[model samples]
Target: MRFSDFALGLGVAVFGIAVLLHVRTFPEIPGMQYGPAFFPGLIGAAFLICGVALVVGSVVRGAALTERFAERPAWFGDRLAVWRAVGVVLSVVAYALVSPVLGFLLTVALLTAGLLLLMGVRWVVVVPLMVLLPLFLHYGFAQGLRVPLPRGPLELLLF
Candidate 1:
């Protein structure tokens, strides 16, 4: 997908404005000079400046600034790309529904494997990553972050 500099700039400016506005409500840390909002506020200011620059650049260049961002994407005619995109959406939906029942490890493993296969990854590479990646992620989130993961029969045994 592509967007005219004008539209993209406007979007960035709006987002920056939103961030700056919302960050004002965050209370300053009692002991520290930099509050939670400090870094984000700086980022928002940067975004605002860059967005204005893009808008100005587009205006100066006299490009088609009013054109719709996504009239027809470059990949519109690519069937495989379209299907892969659909598969990603479907995968997310499937994960939401199946994760609770199958648990985090199993659900993520299945999702990773399925997506890898769909993307035409070799079985040799897919098999190891399918098992290892989910395990590592589960350990990191569940153990390191102390986040509670949904436990199914398999995880009930391991975790």
Candidate 2:
């Protein structure tokens, strides 16, 4: 469930570098100083900086750098862990099977609430998340990214 700081930092640094390099291929906009790559490139740069900081900090802290790359998670021995894992997998499968028909908003709302309850989150938390999280995702994917999410009767009423 976890990796040593050195290992984790190395992976993050490599991922950050990859992102930065990949974003370099995005074509510039003719009239704009900031193109399609602007935000993503900034994010990649931030990642690179953070990753380097993590690596340096870990090294400076005198952590043996020999910490186990991975340790058996405590949950592995717990009986309910299997049910929890199964619940998560079932949620994903259910989402894939029903998302188009239910629409992104409804499907995500249901999935969020179900998973939260499965993980023993209280109703006070789950209720608001069920509503707000779906709307946030809809805005991010549908409005911000301009991706076309399937529309159901509820979406027709709302959007």
Q: Candidate 2: which stretches are off by over 4 Å?
A: 98-159
Write model 2 residue lDDT over 127-148, tens digit each, in one string.
9999999899889999999999
Q: After superposition, how far is residue 25 of candidate 2 from its true place, in Å?
A: 1.9
Flag clash pairs in model 1.
Answer: none
Q: Which window of 10 residues has the lowest lDDT sum in candidate 1?
A: 63-72
lDDT (tens digit, per residue) of candidate 1 on 1-159:
687888889889999999999999999989998999999999999999988988888888886456665456867798888888988999999988998999999999999999998888999999999999989998899999988988897798996
Question: How many clashing residue pairs appear in each of the predictions shown?
Answer: 0, 0
Reference-based TM-score of each model: 0.61, 0.54
Model 2 root-mean-square deviation: 8.7
Which residue pairs in candidate 2 collide? none
